[model samples]
Target: MATFTPTKPRTIGHVDHGKTTLTAATTKVLAAEGNAKAIAFDEIDKAPEEKERGITISRSHVELPIVSGSGLYALQGTNEELGEKAILKLMDADPVRQLYRPFVMPIEDIFYIQGRGTVATGHVEQGTIKVGEEVEILGLTQGEPLKTTVTGVEMFKKLVDRGEAGCKVGLLLPGLKHGDVQRGMVIAKHGTLKTYKKFEAQIVYVLSKFYLRTADITEKVQLPDDVKMVMPGDNVTATFELTLPYPLDHGQIFSLREGDRTVAAGVVSKVLS
Candidate 1:
């Protein structure tokens, strides 16, 4: 008799977390050492304004080379061919794809959440958000709202608690109706979320109404809550507050900016006063 082992799927996280840089480095090393072949995706659009602002307003998939076997490859831009080793697939699909189809119950609101936190809701906009998967926040071109990973899940009064990624999930958050879920709140296991009060982060200004000044608090509106304002100066570090409960953790990253500059880095701290 032969033993059985499962082959893991080829997947990659969102490209924002320096994944592209790492991929390029790995490809160079592989080619230089003659170990493997690397595939690259270089698609250009009129969105440098959005991308430089650190927001990926669109969804795309990219495939690279890993350690598997040899094959014909598909690169984004050109009809070029390269030797194959294994294939690495890079996809940027939000969990909402499952809920949407050609025609269906129209979602009254298209809620958006920035990266890697949690969103609380009875119904997703279109598709099912896989457990432990990061969903894209699609709206403004500033950048993808956030890259959040689903850590836990529950459906209705009963907890289906665990399920495989890429599967449709019907969840139920107690005492919370479908309408109660605001877009910004990342959904995960109830009570597992740590809402933030204050923190210091880096931000860039993009299509903003006014220039952000130091110490001048401002408010950013997302669905259920508003991101309290902070007068940040051109990609500078500053303090911020959240208007509602946010599921946050120490070192967890969110998007911010001062003006024209996108991509602000922040670390969570104590609750607001």
Candidate 2:
């Protein structure tokens, strides 16, 4: 039972300076050394088929992996293309915070690759993981554990065989359809997390300032459920229910938004299962 604290290594170089070649070569060297199981990550590049046919990414970053204990740094390989940031949209927050204690990754979005399968992108809230290990999707199914293995991990366009607590990562789950998962789910080791539909919380009502009259609703459109009528107040205890089951713990703070606007902020007071 090995724990992987993966790292993302992006090659900083210019166009045609052999970044892909450098990535691919790293995979080969690691495979030869039996250090890690190397995986060459390739993103599609478009050139007129009459010209280069299938030229991989030339300027952007891509992830290539070598799965094992510490995972391999062997991505510098093969033909592939990806965004300059590589895997998912990179959001660099908490730059000064090195806090890695828990092992919960809440799904922000999921993307599908033509050949690789479903990729769930999120920031590591706590803990670490490596490819080839099994993880459970908390709060997605009722009692039935949504278990899947990590086929791949990537960050900032570099193949990361494992991941740490604070990195923005893309977890690759092969054979999963995009619809099988959604935003706001948590990924964790099996049996390590819990999901709930109803909870008690203390919420600061913000939308109260815009107390819409009954005429507003009848005359126009409906607001988001979270934007219910409320009076401005210090803090109020509220019962919260998610349309879908979601992993939540006591003391968790969350934003309640109506469409795109924040209506309220909540802190978990008690988790009702």
Candidate 3:
């Protein structure tokens, strides 16, 4: 069977530059060449306002398959204004260092099978894990992290011997009950994860009023004194304090939301406490 690696082709350009149209055209061309399946133009720009204004108002993603060796890859495609040389430069840039980091999976849900024990389902954020290896469950409980053994790994219902970064898999953890684990908890390679209630982060495009939300709670937080006047598109370093500790690590990215809308994004720069 032939395997395909998913690649994201970024469409970045000024307004009304036909970024969406170009993407739709490229999809059709790739389909004609048997490189990808054709996606309908309407599907690419389906928002009502987008149809009325004939421009995309929100960021969107389209998966394009590239026939390459097994691994994740990124492809940059921009309008003429950005130029092909810019894309070439990006392709030659160094790969992100976080891709090589340790295993970390924030538990999204938990299930208890009658005979197999507890199953924790989540997407692996980074690193690799295999059956029979030990993992630490962090966050849900305070103080020390909980250790558990991975009895099995299953992806899309098919039993796999191991799981790695980018894979959404279920880990069969024995000796754990449903109540013992929750959505906000995190699982990582033993001794590699830490829980923190305070941390310094570099945030971008944050609104004046927003809440720091995690899996279990959403708490209002203030921007540091230096960045209180930050505006959209500005990058600022700020310290954030959460009501509860979470399994956070350096370079881990998070979102700041006001109610249901995400107004900003941030990356953990340092753990303060």
Candidate 4:
């Protein structure tokens, strides 16, 4: 018996080039060989417009079994032409394991222990942190990054020596008073984070009224003169100017709220100044 890896192969070419038909035929052949359960001709194109014009106008995903290692693979080009060597090469070139992101924790709440000093609590947005490592407090005082050392880390009321992305942990910062840190300040590895006052973002699902909320501060967004109001499902590139600087990075997500309700969201595309 041969081991198989689940792969999603994409077909790309000019329109009306039988891409859908080719995908349908591949599924049929795999089903005939007892690899796949059934053909997916109808599944490839279910939209009314696609059936009328016989062309795929949107993206579709289909799973096919390929003989390879245990992990999933995204096979490009012709699936039938991919051999064991090609599959192994694709697996070796996997970009997921090569990424290295720095530690970033946005302070949501702060507390001062009577004996230990200031404790900043927030979820680790990315990367990992260990005790005794130095971190910078950003977005607090304008143009100033406060350097502090992580003396201890606690999570869920238990002391921990290290923390990683997605974990809510409280870092013990010595020599800092309760007044030094505030909500919305980001604790990050020194020199890894930067403060920005203006940025470009792609806004979508625009509600009737929305304000950009970040770091416990809410600011109303001013739109361009030509645009009156942003509607739902609108994808527009807009520039945001903040009254105060924020520790921001590309690809960071922020929410658009209307009063007490969150109406939309956007991702930071580029940071300007």
Q: Pick the candidate with the highest TM-score.
A: 3
lDDT of each: 0.36, 0.60, 0.68, 0.68
Tell me each candidate's TM-score: 0.34, 0.55, 0.60, 0.59
Clashes of each: 40, 19, 0, 0
Candidate 3 lDDT, 50-114, residue by residue in tens = 88987788763322333222111112333522433332343344333234678888888899999
List, residue by residue over 1-273, the lDDT tens digit for candidate 1: 222222322335564643343344345435555755754423322388655765444443323334432222322222222322222222222232333321111112322334423324334322343444543322111222333345444432233534323432333223222344343334432223344444444444322221121111234422113434434344444456544334344454445454646534444433342
Output the lDDT of residue 194, model 4.
80
User: What's the TM for model 2?
Assistant: 0.55
**Candidate 2: minimum summed lDDT over ten consecutive residues — where?**
211-220
Model 4 lDDT tens row, 1-273 = 222222344536478665665555544444555666644556777789988987788853322334342111112224543432334443244323211488888888998889988998987877888889999998747768889899888775667777777667889999887588888888889988788888888887564342332275444455667877787887777777776778877887887766777777889898887
* Stretches of candidate 4 exceeding 4 Å from the true structure: 1-99, 205-214, 220-222
What is the Å distance of residue 16 in model 2 from its true position?
Answer: 26
Clash list (residue pairs), candidate 3: none
Model 2: per-residue Cα lDDT at residue 225: 63
Listing every candidate in turn, what is its Cα RMSD in Å to the true structure after a full C-alpha superposition? 16.0, 13.3, 10.3, 14.4
